[model samples]
Target: MASGNDMKMAEETYSGFIGLVKWGTILTAVVAVIVVLLIA
Candidate 1:
């Protein structure tokens, strides 16, 4: 069984990973928009 501290650490890690992915997707979208504007 997982300890309480271990569960907390895992949750933090998962949340951090999600945040990184979310920001990465946002950045990719912004870049795409900029490129489209430049092309247009």
Candidate 2:
């Protein structure tokens, strides 16, 4: 019961952390591309 909920919460937090990293990398790549275009 409590352990199950704790496990679920831990998984959710890990996934959220991964999602933030993935999106952050993507956002940085996109901004870099835009800057390159502007420079060119």
Candidate 3:
């Protein structure tokens, strides 16, 4: 049984991780497009 505080902390960590991953994916795609354009 997890305590309320522990659950809240876990949720916050998960949200932050998700946000990081979302931004990372967007950055990767943008960089890829730029690279392709430079090559072409």
Candidate 4:
């Protein structure tokens, strides 16, 4: 079993990872749109 501190740390890491992924996806989409506009 994990300790309370370990669990808290894991949660914070997961949250940060999720936030990074979310922004990454949004950035990718925005860049894709910009590229398409430039091409068209």
The C-alpha lDDT values of all candidates are 1.00, 0.97, 1.00, 1.00
lDDT of 3 at 12: 100
- Position 19, candidate 3: lDDT: 100
Q: CA shift at 18, candidate 4, in angstroms?
A: 0.3
Clashing pairs in 3: none
What does candidate 3's lDDT look like per residue over 1-40, in tens digits? 9999999999999999999999999999999999999999
Candidate 3 segments whose C-alpha is farther than 4 A from its true place: none
Clashes of 3: 0
Full-model lDDT, candidate 3: 1.00
Query: Can you write out model 2's per-residue Cα lDDT over 1-40, one digit (the tens) per residue?
Result: 5698899999999999999999999999999999999999
| TM-scores, each model vs. reference | 0.83, 0.75, 0.94, 0.94
**RMSD of model 1, in Å?**
0.9
CA lDDT, candidate 1, residue 7: 98
Clashing pairs in 2: none
lDDT of 4 by residue, 1-40 (tens): 9999999999999999999999999999999999999999
Which window of ten consecutive residues has the lowest lDDT sum in model 4?
1-10
Residue 27 deviation, candidate 3, in Å? 0.4
Q: Deviation in angstroms for 20 in model 3?
A: 0.2
* Residue pairs of candidate 1 with colliding backbone atoms: none
lDDT of 3 at 38: 100
